[model samples]
Target: MDLFGCMNVKGRSGTKSQSVKFFILGEEFNDDAKKVEVYKKSIDLIKHGSPRGVITPIFVTYCSRFSRMIVCYPYFDESLSDWLKRYKGGSSNLPYEIRIMIRNLLAAIEHQDINRLEDISPIVCVKSKRDNTMEVKVILLPVQSEQSSKAKWRTSFSSLLRKNMHQTWLEDKDFEAFLLMLESNEYTLENLMGHPVLQDGDSNGRLILDCFRETLTPAQHKELEEKLNVQKYDGGDWRLRLQGKTPLENMSKRSTAYPGHDFLWFARKTVAHFNENDAKFKNATVNRVPAANVIKDLYPGFISDLYKLSLEPQYLNRALG
Candidate 1:
């Protein structure tokens, strides 16, 4: 029989653990002997499989009363869904959080492909730990009787990305391109890992803000300091400018003290040069401008440019030799 549910368990060491939540394969078998056989095969596959980013079951037992297999895994701090919910309004670590998720998820999928564990749905079982550093855990569930094909797994993975990720961290173009490649089914796992979007570097908006600050004229800097009361442009200020909003207007004291109309005009003009040339700037007059919300959306080509810059001989020699 194909069935799945969640249950809390107590470990031998006295720590509480969670049972693996199974993904139903829509296959049903009435025979007890056949169910036992399927359970054994699933256990063996997990026992021998060495899949990075996949959690190995700590214990497995056949319950005669329930006529079901109980698979318990080590305690996970939280599910991926819960973790993402905490940051729905957005956070500074969102880029790092997303990058870690993508890396582990891809690794788990690669492992599944290698071990022929296509029936194991890692995407459904994603978890995370937040002790010292953020980490993603892909809990591998028990194998199903009628295993899902590799194509099915790919389609499922792609659908999950499209559903959950498009509105979040990644830029639209980057995410769409990656999704296209994923759905293509031609690229190897290694090739996908090497893709520019997957490659890690820096996503710090402060760096880009500093670059913008450098382009500011001496008079413009003075105006920003005196009128807007902005000494240095931080990430928050940069974000407001990107959204075609003024930082001074958002602050209670500044909003009251400064002339709202005049300050907003000055602020817009101050950032006009950078916004027009370097960043994606929306018109403040527009009722709803679909602008880049996260730092990942700003300068989508910057990360790739940084990668190319690193490959240059001057940078390579300085860093390596």
Candidate 2:
């Protein structure tokens, strides 16, 4: 398939945008019957099965004069290949840009999964508007069967990532972890947002929430905020909050055996101290729990203190004690 830019093309209602219009020219079919059948199928699929972030051609027809199938798509700011070239050396917003690209690609794959469309090879395009916002436009084509395997999809996405990001970006630990998750097909939009590298900061030093607020709709932003309940503390750590309490507070209150005893109190203090001063503990607590041995190695003294405190009168007299 070949994409062509059309400028000043008026609509059937005699309307047109000031910007250039773009359309795709598909390879010629065997005959008019084949062309008509493909065109109708494309239209019907788009009407009933089109997924968000995937772009379907606006108009599809057999151009008798040119004897080719023309698929007219909506206007897009630029092709992904061109955009990658423009930012070849990397940019301040490169990480965020790549995030958006991956997100859209996944969305396209989700579309394919839901509709059971096989052998799809996406022609990725982008729309970077003046407001510093971007939209990814995935044009799905039946060019290859590589999409059937998660491994192949990872390879394809990694190639695209290599085009837009620098070696340093790819080498980042969080990025590597993200790629691992992608390879395992364990990634989702929510997981992507909370991925350490993305949460760290964009190239321009903007935080994840700021990036999300700029890109997501108000409702979506609100939903995410409620779901994560995460806030960046002054110490530069993103902490998850429950209700109006910090993680330590929530954990402290969760102890059934020593609810209001000195054991729970010391545990809470230990958690708070570890959260603030211990790098390993902080990293472990960011989005998940550390292994038992890891916790023991890091806080043997604290664990001992809690154990000793648990034998105290207050803890021993507790209902579950």
Candidate 3:
């Protein structure tokens, strides 16, 4: 149940610029006062805080307030960086392995009230040291706060969808917020990138978008409400308890349907996975990657004018039509 000095620290760590983090050993937390609270919360999150079968300690703590201040978790496996490195660039293929882990982690993030989960990128999850035998255990760290919440939300959420790359079941409006953020970018798709897309970008325009994205149809929102009712706080699999109301599930069917024409816009990314590797490395792919338009599957006529605005950098002024 306890992993003593089980520390394997790596990555861009410990700096004023470094986002908030907790060490696996006594070093897990720096703030003495909040450490206890964080550890307790973490324990609650683990469902099985004892860390008996985890590959890494879910966390380290003592009943003593001092012990509670410290926490520990396994090293992050298949990090966003790892994903990019393995794929050679931006070609994120959603294999089953990544899918299960990612689904679990996003679910974890949905449950996390921590504001810091926003800044991090290329989302990842790790098995627990205590019981590699149990269901997957993931640790999502803090994201940078200084960046505009909108930008951070855009990057993180898009990165999740891009990595998962699910087809056929988007439910449209369900994930519109993840793609075209509501608080900031809804009025103009240009501002659709961060959490709460912002409350007041263009009041009238936002009012319309808010009506669409947040105001899910009664049936759609009803399922979420129903599942949330059976929440069992015993640290069991959150997916099991939430009755399928996952972070991804919040997406709803958009009342505003796009034009009927379907087109695959992307041509492959700079960073794709190695699922089709051969000879010595039989896990990499060599296929045509394609564009991920701001909106896809639009009516042919409307598709030409799909997105006049670009996100700058790699997509700068490139004709989307």
The model with the greatest lDDT is: 1
Per-model C-alpha lDDT, please?
0.46, 0.46, 0.32
Ten-residue segment with the worst summed lDDT in candidate 3? 261-270
Model 1, position 107: C-alpha lDDT score: 70
TM for every model, in the order presented, reads 0.51, 0.51, 0.32
Window of ten residues with lowest summed lDDT in model 1: 285-294
What tens-digit string does per-residue lDDT give for candidate 3 at 1-321?
Answer: 122343445457644231123343334454565555555556555563322112223554544544534445555454444453554322112233433443444344333432333323324444445875223333432211243354555465565554444442233332443344322443333333121211111232222222223334445334323322212222342223223422211211121232110011011110111122233221121122211121121111111112212232222222221
Error of 3 at 306 (Å): 12
Q: Which is the better candidate, 2 or 3, if ranked by lDDT?
A: 2
Model 1, C-alpha of 318: deviation from truth (Å): 22
Error of 2 at 44 (Å): 3.5
Deviation in Å, model 1, residue 84 alpha carbon:
2.0
Tens-place lDDT per residue, model 2, 1-321, is: 565556666667786554444444555463656666667656665675557667665567666666566666656666655665566554222355566656655656654632222223344555556675766556643222232465566655665565455666665434655666555555554444444344322221122112232234445434433433222111222122223434444454554443223232323444444434567544534333322212222222222222223233443244122
RMSD, candidate 1, Å:
12.1
Model 1, 200-265: lDDT tens per residue? 422222223332233455454443344333312233433344454443224323333334233333
For model 1, the stretches where C-alpha displacement exceeds 4 angstroms are: 1-30, 64-67, 89-94, 113-130, 145-150, 202-297, 301-321
